[model samples]
Target chain A: MKKLLNDPADLVAESLRGVERAHPELRVDHEHRIVYRADAPVSGKVGLLSGGGSGHEPAHAGFVGPGMLDAVCAGEVFTSPVPDQMAEATKNIDGGAGVLHLVWNYTGDVMNFDMAAELAGAETDTEVAAVVINDDVAVEDSLFTAGRRGTGAAVPVEKITGAAAEQGRSLSELADLARRVNDNTRSMGMALTSCTVPAKGTPTFDLPEDEIEIGIGIHGEPGRRRVPLAPAREIAEMLMEPLLADLDFTGGDGVLVFVNSMGATPMLELHLMYAEIAAILDNAGVVPVRSLVGPYVTSLDMAGCSVTLTRFDDELLRLWDAPVAALGLRWGM
Target chain B: MKKLLNDPADLVAESLRGVERAHPELRVDHEHRIVYRADAPVSGKVGLLSGGGSGHEPAHAGFVGPGMLDAVCAGEVFTSPVPDQMAEATKNIDGGAGVLHLVWNYTGDVMNFDMAAELAGAETDTEVAAVVINDDVAVEDSLFTAGRRGTGAAVPVEKITGAAAEQGRSLSELADLARRVNDNTRSMGMALTSCTVPAKGTPTFDLPEDEIEIGIGIHGEPGRRRVPLAPAREIAEMLMEPLLADLDFTGGDGVLVFVNSMGATPMLELHLMYAEIAAILDNAGVVPVRSLVGPYVTSLDMAGCSVTLTRFDDELLRLWDAPVAALGLRWGM
Candidate 1:
């Protein structure tokens, strides 16, 4: 694979330099591998911090801004940021109010953020709250692996919960909101091709050109089943079937839909899938109140899309309507 | 290419449906292919709108939010959004305060945004100001291509301009600010691997595992030259030498450095590259005011990195310090 990188070893550090350089208001604590808004210690506001593997752009770091995450700890590609990085980030961004840790379902992210919170609570007066988003419906509740991968649900969870924090909600309130959003949201993704990590320089999996992997995880994990490329309607059914079975989108006022690209899927196709998914929902008597189609969250250039449904109530909608400023997911100034 | 999409035609619509479902605060006009903040036409504010190809997640569209874009027009992957989309986005977001069209240097983006502005002007009292960001220092000024490709410059442009817009700066002033940022900024990228567009599920360009392409454009376009993968320091020199020559970073009070990942590059390597880039700028007598490293604007999951520098004035710094809330770029509150 021909690439445009200086060196595999230098890729991560160089990218961080670029981020810090572009947004001077956002400080890159290179020593700690954490990113924070330059205006640190945003007095009297509960600081929200998150971190995860580096490949997911705009997930943890891109989300650092007002009304969103206060800091983002970045690890190597596909690896969670270390505890030290998270600890420093939490400390740097923590205001007198408190701190909330929102992370995805990945084991690395969960464990690392937990460690950082522990370290943070021991050292500072900052109270801490943590929420893990496990919204993927692809993985059933099983004992073998962590059940359900967190996919598109993380985007809205962060956006809405971040807004709650910005509104000066109590730490418990923010944590509750995060937990509720996580509980209501369910996501399932499919992959057409495996993406190559820069260091690996090869496809992550051997997917035949004519086949597709259903229920693929964000980290290039194998899906529940590999199937031939099907029509949009059928594929939507395949994705939605599991999600519908997992949750009752029918007994609610409506559900929010997120058609997320797995990095490489274009908006043209994403919208097409959206049309079909909407039809499927309509057929199933599921009213759609809100929708998000795009690569809000992604796997590196993987040719796939994930469907996330979050059944929302009035409070969730109000929180969702709150203004947020981040690198992705923003509205209501 | 085994893509997980149901049908190639359904891709975009499905994705947009997901976007709409996921983000309740953003209004998605699937037919028009425009995404707008639900509270657009902000009563009295310059409507800031920008967009382009789809694969660059968190760009153009991901940037729509408070303190940033009022709306975003998403095009097909690697292709500029159509003029109609931009026109609709402009009209939908226009609040009788006029509009500012911030576009990148791609021929398609420039032409389409211009057409949209013209169309928008014909129907409404929406005075439109256009500014094109041509910050990539990869290509020397040439007649053959649209100046230097706007690489990492879009982030700062959107950010500073968004701040100006939030401050209630008029359309013309926002345009001027964008132009000033463009003038002061320069970027150069190197790719370690060619990225595969989702529709075309193969490497855009074949590259041996050890080879890298320097002076690359954002959209998987052929770069100025291909070279063997080198040490981070040497690669930093290779990218920065051309950028420094194009613009004198020396004696500048301080410089903002952006080490952006195209995608697929890890954060670990980005920091190392940042250190190397800092050394290069230091040798050139460029004091670093700030640094950013991440995959802000990306080309699918392309494995590459770009370095961008902006010589900042106090005004620029203040604007940079102003609060911004968007899905893609956010900073001071």
Candidate 2:
């Protein structure tokens, strides 16, 4: 595999070093493996934290800042972080208010974040809570996940909850808001190609030149179906049909739509897909209030995309528009 | 040929539709094919405009906003825009303070923008000035360019010049700043694979599985050499050595290092590469005062990266830090 790395075993740490040097506004605790906002631990404000496998970049780490995540604990590529990393991160971000963990729904991630929360509860006097994201509509189960796998919606959940937390919400309130946001979001993805795991040193799956895989997971797990490659309009229909059917999207509810690149898909294709998606939503009488089209959440160098729809109202729209200062998504700051 | 578009002919227009819908803060003039900041044509501030072929998402179009380009004119993919588009954009953005055209040093771009300026000069009272960017050091001359091809330095030039324009700098002052930025900046790029132009329905160039092309242009033009694939550190050296040799970079000058993914390169690998770059800079007693690593300027779905270093001073640093609101790079607002 042609990848820009040295000693595959040291990918995560080395990347963190680069991440540390890139953003002075960010404080990278190399020893503890925590990426925190430079001005973190705001007293009396809820602390927001998220962590998952490292391949889905700009997710946990790139989203670390004032109005999104206070700190992010990173694991190895496609691997879960140890409990100590999360525990230390929780302790540091925990001010007098509390800490909240936004864990993506994976067996290892769920278990490890749970262990870290328990350790933080036993070791520190800070209150802790978590909202697990399981928004993927592609499958009810996956290879490494118990239920539906969390996908693109994790980005919006982090942004919305962080905004609420910035407004001085309590621990329980933040948890409830997180759960609400997760419940209202749904995502579906497809892959034209598979990404190679660095350790594997080869592509995870081989795709025929003329065929495409639908409902594929972020990590190359099997999806709902594989079909003949088609135009972008058909692909959008295939992905969005299930999402629209699964969610109770109300007319004039003011929706937020995200067309995310899995990895290698360019913005040209994503925007083309978004144009089709916008037409689909318009035909359904749903007004798209906000639209984000790019690689906010991605698999490593995989050529595909995921579609996410979040039913928006006054509160969610406000939170979505609130100032967020993160590397991945920043506006109004 | 695996791109997400209904018809290859409609790629540019459809993407613009999505672009218009995605950012309500910016206005899309579909007729003339220009992206304008919603509150453009500030009375006393000099107007900034840049444009080129499509496909390069977020380059000219994504750079349009406050403290950046007041307007951007977009052409078809890899094809120069007609003079009418740029002429119309010039007339609209000129608010008594004149307009600055930042053209990349491509034959089509220079020829067409020159025509547009002449047209605007004959028809209206708006004064037009331009500073062409030609910082790619891969070769003194290349495939489609007269001297050198403009690549990553286009990003910093727009940013620095935009900041100066926002400060009410005269048209000539902005032109001088742009020249200074272009003269001090040097860039070199390499590609692991080739990208397919939509209209062509095939890869632009052939790259073998084990061999890579160094010093590639954004349009997939041939580079200086094709070498056997190497590790990220060695590749970093290959890229940085040429850049260092091309310019007189100093220790106390305060550097702005931009490691840009051509397209399709993941952030993980980019960060990993950045680690190597940071170490190389440190060993040379140089500190990167600012760093931007991602797909800011891209060739459509090409798997490669480019490195750009801008020897920075207090003026450039202040301009870089200036707040600009655009979709691609937005912060400090």
Candidate 3:
């Protein structure tokens, strides 16, 4: 409950106010809780819209900029945004090329984005297509998801697909590319501690001091199991086993290895974990052509880390390397 | 401690190994524990060397890259790096134009870096100038410092001076510019809970559940006082009042407002806190020309944040805006 917030109800709105001020390149629709690039609707460029709960920050809202998302509809912490917010954002960011919805594979998010796409299509002449990402290999079904929970892969998916969109790709092409990125990407998460929602003012679940939850979902969903705390080396194995099994990441153009912090995990530990994961990859003959290590997508204050691997082709690699100016992920610009 | 580490003794080295693996742009010397730009000794550019204890990550080591730092010496967790490491880094990065040692104001760090500068001076033909940063306005003298603790201002000092160095500023000129940047910057941190060092396996200090330590140091040193936890608005006032009182951030080319998380504070909370801080700045007529909100400087897993305001002139502003590709801070490149 020791959070830097005024009221739980005002968290998302107030934070958006700060985002608006901190990044002048972004314009926040405070009323609808939509964050859009200041120069959104870039003529013939397809609009890229993605969103989910607010707690997983730098995900939906922070990714809004020139090379990434055109707009993002932010919901309350750990809750899906209403369809109205998404529909409004879609209409606003849509250019002549059309709009693409990057929906993370959560039941609530998928349903809402679907409804939003329908609403946008009915209300405006905007062509909308949705690509649902389910890259988390941690669980087949979880508390908030029917299939695999989309976790860290959203970062690479958004980056690669957004880069393609910036190149004036058609909406269908962008959707296909997003799906291809998701198909090649796999993620697994484990938590050292549960995060406390500001509204609840308590940890979502109780984890013993000496235990950790493996294969955990972003919103404290029950994972594969709890186990006694182990070293980071073992933890990396537990995470990598499922990821490598779920996806063939050995060949092609190698892989983009991402070691993400689930909020409270420091960069030092993330780097350490990356070394462990890299060592494992080396043993498995998996070459990591590119690597990202940091807290790009995160749960609120959960002290944990996640591993994501995307087996990339030359095209996906090129798109990943393209310039991106989003607050969440920025490089090559 | 619930840290994702194998052995506390090997934490720094293991993390550095991961750093080396993750960022191919930077080269890490495992023996000396120095992280240097892959292209160190950049012909004639003055070498920018900064280092401190570990734990306050993305500080010295993460800043090693183009338009930032030439090299960084890393110490053990919350422990000062030895003179040998600093001396070795100095010799390697010196490009005949000379080397500048950026020392945070902790006693151990300043003494060690001063010794390293002397060692480099006596051992090699490399000219070295030192700039000691003591930007924390929390106290006149605290636990590990004589004047002010170099808290969050190392980022701006390194950035501005690093940019100047990249522009071919001489060692002495870079030293002067770094000192100027440090003088104009002021920072104050607060902690809601104490952080646990991996070796220590316990909280650094005892902080009750309902209270927070204002003006807290990054290393969990005693702050001004412990007060009952207040709303983010009041907390912002508590942090800003002292910063504003110590210096007039109202005029000039405005200020560079940086709100840094101490580690565990989530981006959602950080953004909300930024809103509170921005409103206070607006009321005080402190026009923030630039703002960086995130966990750039951190204290392991402590749950809190710090605010830094660097009163900028045109030159400093230009330097701050320069492209930096460091892993810790990257933009406009």
Candidate 4:
């Protein structure tokens, strides 16, 4: 593969070195592979943390800064981080208020974060609370997940919970808020092309040029089905049908529609997809109260897009609009 | 080609619809195919307008907001916008303080924008100034450019000049500052693969799997040469050697190092490349006071990256640090 890397084994660490150099506002723990906000462990403020495999960048590490994640444990590519990394990050970012782990509902990630919480409780006097997010309606189980795999909702979940944490909320309150955000959010993804892992110099999966994988997982896991390639309008219907059926996003304070590029897809296509989705929503009488369109959470060099809809109330909207300085998602600051 | 689009003919207009729907803060004139800041003609603020082909997204249109471009004209994919759109945008955004046209140095773009300036000058009372950016050090003359092809430096030029305009600089002053920023900046791009323009439905150029194009232009124009695929460190050397040779980025107030993805390159690779570039700069005793690493300026789904270094003075640094709320680049607000 023609990737800009020296050694596949050294990819994550070397990339983290660049992240450390590029963002002075963040502190990187090279040994443990943890990225922490420089001013982490805010006095008496709830500490927020989230992480998964490293390929879905700007998710955990890029979200570390003021008004977002306090720390993140990055794993190797699509592999889960060890419990030791998470436990160390939890201990370090724990303020007097406590620490909250926002775990995406991948089987390995959930298990590891659980073990990390247990380790933190046994070692330090930190109160660790965990919230598991399972918002992907693509499948009930995948190759790497036993339940519905968490996909795009991690963004809004982290943003809203981090805002609540920045407001000095308790660990339990942040946990509840995160769970609420996840419950209200639904995401579905499709892939036109598969991404290649650095370790495996070939694409993670094979996708013919004339076909696509609908409801595909972020890590090239098996999706609902493979379908013939179609226009964005049809693709939007394929993604939105299950999402609307799974969640009641028609009423309340409207929905926060997030149209994200899955790495290789350009903004032109993402915006075109957004217009198709927005047209569908408009016809369905679903008002989009807030919208985010870009590549926030992405697979590595995967050509596709995902749609996440969060039914937001005033509180969630307020928190989303709050000033944030994270590299992945920054606004109002 | 796999892309999320309906019809290639309707791509630009449809995507602009998505942009208008997604960002309520920006207003889009569908008839003129121009994106404008919602509060255009900001009393006495000098207007900043930039545009070119549609494929290089988040360039001109995405930069329309506070502390950035006041208006942007959109052309078809990889095609220069006509003079009518630019003239209409100029007439609308003029706040009685005149307007500045930020033109990328492409043959069609330079010619069309020149005609637009004349049209605006003769038809309206608005004074107009122009700054043509030609920061690419790839070649003295290329397929579509006379001197140099504008590449990654459009971001900083628009940013610094936009900030100056926000600070109430006159039209002539903004034009001078833009030109100064352009003169101090140098950029070089290398592509691992070729991009597919939506209309063509084929790769812009042929790139074998084992080789890469160094010193590639943003629009898939012929680069310096095709070379065997190398590691990120060696690739960084290839990109940096020419940039440093062309511009003396040492001394003064240091340099602003920008590592940008040419669309398909992920943050993981971009950050890794940034580390490699940083090490080279460190060895060269070139201090980087500010840095931007991401896909700010991009080609459509081309797997590659470009590096830009601008020698910044205290004034330029201050303006660079100013708050910007554009969709493409947002921080310090």
Candidate 5:
């Protein structure tokens, strides 16, 4: 409730305004709440778009740029963007190479993006493809998602698929690559503190200070279970074991590791967590080809971290090494 | 208290271990608590070095790379690094072009870095120049500081001076440029909640759910005042007015606005605050040529932000735009 916001209802619009101003590299449609790359609709290149609630910043919006998402639609905090906004973004992003919609595995987001695909198809002749991401191993299903909730895997999915798309991959090719990345990726997260939704003006959930929640989702939805607080060593093991088991990560065929901060967590802790994760993976003989540690995807102001490991091949590693220029994750461009 | 740490005593060493594992681009000295460029002593270039307490992450350590600081010494959380570590980093970073030590304005840091300069000079024959940054406009003097506390401006100063050093500026020239950047910059911050040091294992200060501390330092030191919680707009004004009054950010010479998060603050709130700050500067007729919004300089897990504005000219602007490659803040490299 102690957020630095004006009217809670204006959170999305005001933050979008802030995003537009802070990053002249992007353009914001205030009405539809769609953030688009200033130079969108690249000829002969597939358009990439992702949309979701506003709280997990640097996600969909931060991913909009060259070699990544062409457009991102913003919704209210922890709420999905409507079909209208996605449709508009789809229309603007398509440059005849087709449009790819990266939909997280949330029910509202999936349905809205589906409706947007139809509307965009009807309104324009541009072919559209949808790649659903649901890599979170936190739960079998959740209140917000039918299966696993999409979490930190979206970052690399966006980046790798973006690189593939930039290499003139077709809609189907990009869709397949997206799915491959998603299938090869697994994520698990824990929360030391819950985040408050601005409009609700309170924490989404309650817990005593001494305890922690294991397998927590991005939206403060109920996780698998609650547990007593543990040190970074034990916590990193708890998070990493599920991910390594889900993916047969072994030997020299290394994986790309992403230790994402679930908001309100410091880089110090993230680095500490990353070190523990590296040590754990090293002990298992799993080499980390690439490592990223920071808050790329988050749950508002939640205090925690998530560990994501994406199985990598030569092609995937090459694609992952591709340059990307986005507000959320930019490098080598 | 709810930190993902192994032991309170091992936080600094553990985090540095994690840092070395996560980033292959830098080398960490566990014994001396120093993080240096993996490829140090770039032939004829002036070596840039910055160090301080460990808690303010991505600061000195994260800035160690090709175009930034050649090495960074990490001390215990919120405490100044020892003179031995600085002297060792100074000796290692010297590339025959001398070493430039960027010290934050703190009683302990200044005293220690000054000793490091003498030691480095006598032992290694490395001519070291030290630049003490005191850019915080929040307080003229505080408990931890003899004069103004160095805060958010260190980011720009390191970045700009690093670029100058890479461009073959000597130690004296880099020192002068560092001083110019320090003088031209002004910063003010506020906190909605206090940070918890791992050792202390408690909130740095107490606050009711409804109040905020204005002009809070990076160490949770006292600021200008504590006032009732205000909206993002009013709070933006409170931080910006003092900075604007301090710097003559005028026409043709747009200032670089760095809206830094005080750890634990979400980018959503930072972006929202950035919009208000942009509007405020627009109303004041001062153009912001460059803007960076994120948690660059942080107090361990404090929930708030600081606004830094650095007046820039053509050369400094070019230097600001130079490529930097680091784990914390990497771009254009």
Candidate 6:
């Protein structure tokens, strides 16, 4: 395994140091590896927190700012953050109102955040609410493998709900908003190349260069199946078929499409994929109300892309239309 | 030169079509790859517009929601959005309010956004104010090249200033706030491995396994220099010394730090770096008010990280505390 650091063990700690040095407006609890917006406990405002394993960029941490998450606990690369880390972030960011945890549906993430919530509850009066985002349409939502792995849609839920919270909405309202956003959305991704976790120092899987993995998870987990690389048109169908079948957009209220590139895919290819994907959605009698292309939520250096659809109702549309000013997504503010 | 793409030239166009189809709420002008929030020309609010090259995920487009940007134009991967694209986006998103073009400090982005602003002025009463974010402190302010490239700090500027605009602040006030955020920020980055642009289908540069490139740009551009792989502690020094020399954070209010992953750097490493970086800042007597460490702005798949610092005053801090909802960065709302 070729890398540029002194030791593999020091990777996470060292990266956190670099982050602290770079963004002074944020406070990094070095021991906890929690990224928090400097001004915490915005008196009277509820705290919003989210986290998961490392490897996904701008997620969790980058989303920590005003109108989004107050704190984000980052675990080791592709590993969930510890309970202590999440507890620290919660205690630090929780205003008098309470603290809400919006976590993705991963075994480690779910278990760890749950532990943190308990710790936070035991430690303080910061009312804690947990909302797990399970919007990925890839995995069958059965009592198996911690349900569907949360992919791209967690970002929008965090942003929208974070904004609602920022508007001084009650904790219950914020939790409801988060659930609504999660309910309205669904996502699925495919990987063209397996990613090499720096810690593991090896590709997660072995597939020939010409083959692509369908329905892959964000952490380089095996997808539903591996298939030969095909034309862009066919590839778009392969991605959208399951996604379309999983949800019904026939009511025609319009849908928000996010064509997200995994780390290595370029916008050029993303756009091509978008074109073909658009044709499919058009044929499905779905009106595209909001469209987001390019990479928002991403996995490490894996060459692939995910398609996310959020069926927007009037209320959801209003929230989507409402101005937001977070780090990753901002518009009309 | 290994990549999975059909045709290089069709990259941008195809991706835009896909984005358009996926997002029914966003209108995509195929003739010019510009995307606007479906509810654009946001009534009675100053129009905020931002765009640049395509590769920076969740950037300009991902930022197009309420209180952030009104419109975003997409260029080819790692290339600036063209004048026509920006002009159309500006026009469509403008609601008779003056338009503000907040862009990163790249030559192509500056030139193209400038052209779009000029066209925008000729067509309508919409006054266009442009501000380029050049926060990277690595490059000395000289006549040769564009001074310093904007890095992670751009995210906060959009959020904070977008909130100000959302509150019906005058265009000049919004511009001033943006300038303050720009002036108070600095960033420097290093790359461990050169990334391959999808269209180019080749590595951006050659680096031996033992080497690391410092002061690199987001597009996998060559850094200021390359050196043998070293300990994270030493790398922290390499990235921080130049930044410290660029500004005097001594006896200041505080600073905000952002440790940005250049796409492929794992999260574990990011946190490890953050611990060391926090120590360095503490030793420098600079109180770090806040810090954000993660991959917010990214290159396609470069394995490296960047450091960004923004000196914070009370007012700017208050604005930073505002809530925002967007795809990439969400908090404080």
TM-score of chain A of each: 0.95, 0.98, 0.99, 0.99, 0.98, 0.94
Off by over 4 Å in 4: none
Please give each candidate's TM-score: 0.74, 0.98, 0.99, 0.99, 0.99, 0.71
Top-down DockQ ranking:
3, 4, 5, 2, 6, 1
lDDT of 6 by residue, A1-333 (tens): 544355767666666666556555567887888888888878889999998877776576767877678888888778888898888888888778888899888887888889988998898866888898998777764322477778788877887787788789888888888988888788888888877777788888887867888888887777778888877777788889998898897674688888877766655567677778778887988777777765567776688889998888876776776665444555655
Superposed Cα deviation of residue A289, candidate 1 (Å): 4.5
Q: Give one digit per residue, the lDDT tens place, for model 2 in A219-301.
A: 99999999998988899999989998998777645889999999899887888899889888888777888988888788898
lDDT of 4 by residue, A1-333 (tens): 989999999999999999998889899999999999999889999998888889887777888888889999999999899999999999999988989999998999999999999999999988999998999999998899998998889999999998889889888889999999999999999999999999999999999999999999999998999999999999999999999899778878889999988899999988889889999999888999899988888999999999999999889989988988998889877
State the TM-score, rounded to 2 decimals, of chain A in model 1: 0.95
- Where does model 5 exceed 4 Å of error? none
lDDT of every predicted structure (CA atoms): 0.77, 0.89, 0.92, 0.92, 0.89, 0.76
Candidate 3 displacement at residue A285 in angstroms = 0.5
Global Cα lDDT for candidate 2? 0.89
Q: State the lDDT of candidate 1 residue by residue for A1-333, as single tens digits.
A: 443346666566676775665556578887887888777778888888887877666566777877778888878778878888888878877788888888777877778888888998888766788888888777654322376666688877888887787778888888988998899888888987787787898888988877888999887887789998777677888999998898887766577788887765655456567777888888888888877666667776677889999898877777776677565555544
In candidate 4, position B326 carries an lDDT of 90
Q: Residues B65-122, candidate 4, lDDT per residue (tens digit)?
A: 8998999999999889999999999999999999999999999999999999999999
Candidate 1 residue-wise lDDT at B157? 88
True contacts kept of 6: 0.49
Q: What does the lDDT read for residue B332 in candidate 2?
A: 79
lDDT for position B40 in model 4: 96
Which residue pairs show backbone clashes in model 3? Answer: A333-B333
lDDT of 1 by residue, B170-226 (tens): 877788899999999999998887777767768788878778888877787777788
Candidate 1 local Cα displacement, residue A226, angstroms: 0.6
